[model samples]
Target: MIQKLRQSGTLLGFVLILLFFALKLPDTFLTARNLINISQQLSMLAVVAATMTIVMVMNDFDLSVGSMASLSGIVAAMIFTAGYPVWVGLSAGLLVGVLGGLFNGFLVSVVGILPFVATLGTLTVFSGMAFLLSDGKTIFGRDIPTSFSGFARSGIEIGDIKIPMLTITAGLVIFICWCILEHTNFGRRLYAIGGNKEASHLAGIKVVRLRLIAFSLTGLGAAGAGLMYAARVASANPTQGSGLMLDAIAAVFLGMTMSRRGEPKVIYTLVGVLILGVLDNGMTQLRVDSYVREILVGLIVLAAVSVSSLSKRRQS
Candidate 1:
């Protein structure tokens, strides 16, 4: 009973929070349109959080995710500005993410730097690089091809229902991450490494290679988010992705506590992301102080981390 309750707590809270908001603002909060918008808003965070799970599984942080997203957006925007095909620009952005992750991998796996320190350095570098690319200005959507912007906003639409590209992208990434984590040897090795690095190494696991791949996926995921953001707003700014880093990381930890073993899982992370999105929408309707979002998110992170640590200690 205790285990079941514990596992379901986060999800239960999710539903209750929605109910509270719906009760408080019947017309605004309970509307299907509002709910869909909230989901769309958190889609980018979901993508980043999905990959963040992989990094956490190997016991690492990708602080550079925010900047990585910014860099990816800048890359795509610049390509469009130069009149290149939007596909080319997007592909370039994804490649940049991979390269950035590989570099981080080299630093940690080859140069033996701590994951936090390595990603922090890259975060600063990527942030600066983004500004340098755009001259610290927003790359306006009007400057990009109409087709690009249109496709960004285009998705399946059926009468009163619409599914956004960003949502689809996030779903695809989450599905892929879940498959890789749950069904592959690579995923099993990640769990083994996170559970016991020395033992995995002793057992002949290529801990370095596997971890490098994990970090690389973080970069790729961040890039996907950046592209979505840039497309949605039809603009790219160096600072666009900064605030999302903590949120994505927070959701990843939140997800860890949703499982019996405190393992990082994608579905739980989506729930965490949805919690944030719903809170933001609900609070906005209530005219709450914008700062409250930060406070509540901080509290959520703190609680999630504490729960995860406790779960791990009990399991041990």
Candidate 2:
């Protein structure tokens, strides 16, 4: 039993923390409204976290994701405000995101640049472009359609609980990602690359193509998140996605600690996002200062990563 518990410690720890928070703030946390709020608040992070996991699984990272998201949101808002259809605006945003991802892939694969360096350069470029497009202004107007807003605004009631559409969409995405990672050969190849890139390449796994696909998926995820956020707020600013990078990366790292396979998994990443969301909401409910909350989040992520790395080392 002790051995079994040690092997499954991360899942146990996640459960315990969730229960503790739910119990400690029962008056607020146990309510349906709060549950919905937590899900909605974490939706964007969850999307980015999933994408980041895929990138990490490919033994690469995309530092430009947050910037891409910001650019996508700004572009969507600008298009919408210019009398274009919402679908057209959404397509434009997604296209921009895909183009950014393709640029990163080109640098890393064709130019033989390191992933970190390539993405870092693109990050600054994309962010500057976003700022230039916005000209340091927030776009807001009442003409934004209800149909777009309804994508995030609607809710489903189960018993006394109302679950937001944003929450449902995030859940669906997580489920699909989980299936793809756990059941697909492509996912296995991604893990192979992460574990030993040279071996995977020698085995004819098409490392370049896999890495390109992974980066493209990251962009798609970020674009989806930006669209959702823009819809929720009914406005967009060039800086809207500035804070998402840290949160998404934190969730991805936290998730690495939870899976026994030593590979990033979608379900674990979603859980990690939920854990962070709950922490933030609970802290807010308890009136904790934002600075302290940020510090705690960072510490928690560091501790989890350290523990996970130690465990993997021991196992090896």
Candidate 3:
């Protein structure tokens, strides 16, 4: 009964906060336009969070996600600027993302490097590559294809509410990720590894291989996000992916707290990302200073983590 109450309390608190912000900022936060804007703003973060959840569930981390995303975006832009077809550019971007992931996986699994160190090294290398490829300049030109632009611009309208295509894509990706994590043996192995790597290995799980796959998927997701970002902005810069690492990590941790699971869950991650978006939107509507918003977000995350830790202790 107490556990149920705790769970309910956590959910109820989140709901109340959301409602309060909606009511307080009805003209800005609760409007359809703002809701659509929030969706578009957080779509990339949502993608990155999905992959981060997978990696965390496998007891590993990928610090190179932001770098990989930047590199992918640069490559995509270079391809398009070089007159290649949009599909070709997208494929090249995704391929590069996969290669980056595989490289990180090889280092961690085959070379016996720690996941953190391996990804950190790759992160720096990939970021440098992005800058080198772009010649430290943002890629912007009229030659950018119309199809690509439409990919990001297109939306669905329901009454007065307009939803961006990328927003719908994000929802689909989250649902697919949730299905993978909750309904598959691979997912079970991932959670088992997170709970106890040694136990999972002793049970004949291919822990190393699974970890590699997780990292690869993380890279894939980040690259996909970069493509969407480029499509939305119609250009790519070397610094396009900067700061994404922090947002992605925060979303993952927030999701974990809400899920109260040993392993990360996609649905919870999406919810957490929405919570963050709402907070940011609400603060912006109130004309809150950017620094103050950051501080508030940091405090909220810290409090959530503390609560989650305390709950775990009680359960134990």
State the local distance difference test value for candidate 2.
0.81
Residue-level lDDT of model 2, residues 210-307, one tens digit each, is: 88877888887887788888888887778788777778877877777776665777877887798788889888887889999989877877877777
TM-score of each: 0.94, 0.93, 0.95
**What is the alpha-carbon lDDT for the whole of candidate 3?**
0.84
lDDT of 1 by residue, 67-115 (tens): 9999999999999899888889989999999999888888888788999
Residue 173's C-alpha lDDT in candidate 3? 74
On TM-score, who's better, 1 or 3? Answer: 3
Candidate 1: RMSD to truth = 1.8
Best by lDDT: 1
As for lDDT, the candidate ahead, 1 or 2, is 1
Residues 1-316, candidate 3, lDDT per residue (tens digit)? Answer: 5455444444565687779887887667777788889899999889989888888887688888898888899999899989999999999999998888988988987798998999999999999999999999888767567788688999898887778999998888787777778899998888998999889999999988988887888898889888888888888888788677888888887777766463578877787788788888888888889999999899887887777778777887
Off by over 4 Å in 3: 5-10
TM for candidate 3 is 0.95
Question: Which stretches in model 2 have alpha-carbon errors above 4 Å?
Answer: 1-7
